[model samples]
Target: MTQLFSDMFGTIIDNTPYMKAIGAYYAGASEDGITMAMPWREDLVGDPETRVIASGVVTALLDNCCGMAVWDRINAFKAVATLDLRIDYMRPALPGHELKVTAKCYKLTRSIGFVRAFAYETSVDDPVAAAQGAFIVTALKSDATGVKS
Candidate 1:
């Protein structure tokens, strides 16, 4: 198994169909942060003219990256729900370019995890979007089987 899958929470995320379909992969984690990548897909493109990725997809990427950062720090297979996510889109991503997101969990309390993430196409210095969010972490329940859980 990949290092990402070796962790319980990441294993569950890897098996999720939607995440797989979007080509979101765990690049790795470090003391600095957790990184993930979403490979450009034709299906995810919103404007064929610009070949820019959809805003919704970008939001999802940010949300997942934040959640993963929290999970990596917590080192547990817990269910997390996004309390709020705010993204600032700086520019559009070019077609065929991969979107890389690096998320850092700067603060983690008993129930809430605070994260900040940036998405870039080719250069981290020139990010396409930046995000900050919070998530509510809870114990994984047997009844929660879907990816949303």
Candidate 2:
């Protein structure tokens, strides 16, 4: 199947308010999967002194990354919902370091897509968090862009 990540990619991803609010941006995509980045900002610090990013921000980053990976794998613009996302925090991210997240849609069936993602600053092996999630995919109408529900 021909992979599609542009037409519907910007329409849905660029408009995500949560992604924007936390300074998350689409880094790029490769044969491996989709990648996204979040900047470390003073406003995002969980503790004023430690300056570690809030945990919720990392969760959001990984979630969006997973969704995009599913879209890239399916090679179509379809409605996808996160059925479940389990993120295991390996360690707290380094202060003042930008967090990078990459996700791969390793398996896709007619109705479900499975993804595994890692959030890290330096190396994937030394990840700040690891997530494995399943997304429920649904067919779209003729337009193929809108989420039915």
Candidate 3:
């Protein structure tokens, strides 16, 4: 990842309260997006009987991954917020399995970015959930180094 993005997006993620609470971590990067992982934890379970990871956790994971992809596509850090997010839950995430998520920023205009993402455990073909979202891109007053110029 570029230093600017690392500073802008990475730092924000690192410091964000909810993201930190979820224990998601940066996994890798691709040409169009980035990936992250969330390990299964008892505290993340929504149903005690089923021991299944909460859907809300998956939602946060997808949103964060998609947000990261937006920055990756921009190749820099700038202010952006989710404009819309729609998630389709295919199945419950298996307990004790770390969920992996990848999101792609497929399109970007001056003020918006379109993203798609999915969550999987054992295989990408068998996704636990999928999401499509839009984010509002803002003109940030920062230079290449992610510092005001």
Candidate 4:
């Protein structure tokens, strides 16, 4: 990975509280790729009857993975806002299975990044969900002021 992307990854892993709260750990990353792990907990499950994971949790995992892809390309601490995200749920995820999300940034420009991500239970060949999205990249700003310049 480039120095910029490496630096950005470090900044995120070290400073993002939400990422930490969700137990998002960096599995591995390269210049054009990233993998993140999120353990399934009962608290995050949505369907009690089916014992399946919630769609929101799946979305969050994809979002984080996609963001990491962008971060990996930029290689810097930047404020990112999801412009659009599309997720396709292919299969139900069991309660006890941990989800692994792998994302890649194939295209990045001055202010936008495009990424694709997949959530796999144990094998990449069998993905639970697939996602494609774009994110608006901006300079880092304090949370107190939601504005990004």
Candidate 5:
């Protein structure tokens, strides 16, 4: 588990394009969940005057965070499809403030996983967005070498 965490938060994380594009980074990880951060970018601005980050970006951030939490909880990489994701914007994120999102896989069954997540700029209690989602879990197939794909 320790090695998995190191690999995930280390080299493997750096090579992911979407994560890189959004400036996502490992903020923290625990037995139940993982937290990721996305720094605010001028190019991602939703309103010119307010400079608040776009709601779409927040949705993406939470979605990715939730999915990662599921993988971490399962302790293995598995193919999962987002079945449903519902995000509610509580408030607009402050301009230039980095958004931190925490997500957890609360329940896992034979075919699905339930996840919940929240996003905030300064503190978790004061969330800017909250989300609840379900993912369809699938078994990953290995190649001839017998390594999980």
Candidate 6:
């Protein structure tokens, strides 16, 4: 990760109240992607009996992961918003296990970024959820980075 993205996206991740409340943190990141992990906590459970993580929490994780991946792909700090996101839940997250999600930007256009992500406790093959997302990139940061729209 470059300094600008690490500084900007890192700030966003560190400051998000929900992310903090859920105990979300970066597991790892690369120039093309990002990975995040959140421990299973009582308050985060969607079903107390099942001890499954809330779908909403998982959705937030996917969104944040996708957003961060896009920002890193852009290689600069800029205004970006989720244009669309599609998530398919494969199954309940493993009980009492921390869920990890990874996302990568696969395509970049002048105004948009396309990404894919998945959530799992152990392996991507047995995913808890998978996501395909697109984000709208504002022109503000592109000028500085020479990304012509």
- Cα RMSD to native, each candidate? 3.3, 3.4, 4.7, 3.3, 4.1, 4.7
lDDT by residue for model 1 (74-109), tens: 776677778888999998976889998888989999
The TM-scores of all predictions, comma-separated, are 0.85, 0.87, 0.86, 0.82, 0.87, 0.86
Clashing pairs in 6: none
Stretches of model 3 off by over 4 angstroms after superposition? 1-11, 141-149
**Candidate 1 local accuracy as lDDT?**
0.80
- Judged by whole-model lDDT over C-alpha atoms, candidate 2 comes out at 0.83
State the lDDT of candidate 3 residue by residue for 1-149, as single tens digits. 43656345556667777888888888787653677888899999999999999999999999888878888778776777888899999999999989999899999999788999989996678999999999877767632222110
TM-score of 2: 0.87
What residue runs in model 2 are displaced by over 4 Å at the alpha carbon?
A: 1-3, 6-11, 142-149
Model 2, residue 115: distance off in Å is: 0.5
lDDT of each: 0.80, 0.83, 0.82, 0.78, 0.79, 0.83
Which tens-of-lDDT digit does each residue in 1-149 have in candidate 4? 42455544645664667667666677787543788888888777799998787888888878888887887777666877788889999999868888888899889999899999989988778999999998888777545222221
User: Backbone collision count in every prediction?
Assistant: 0, 0, 0, 2, 0, 0
Name the regions of candidate 6 deviating beyond 4 angstroms.
Answer: 1-4, 7-9, 141-149
Residue 133 CA displacement from its true place in model 3, Å: 0.2
Error of 3 at 124 (Å): 1.9
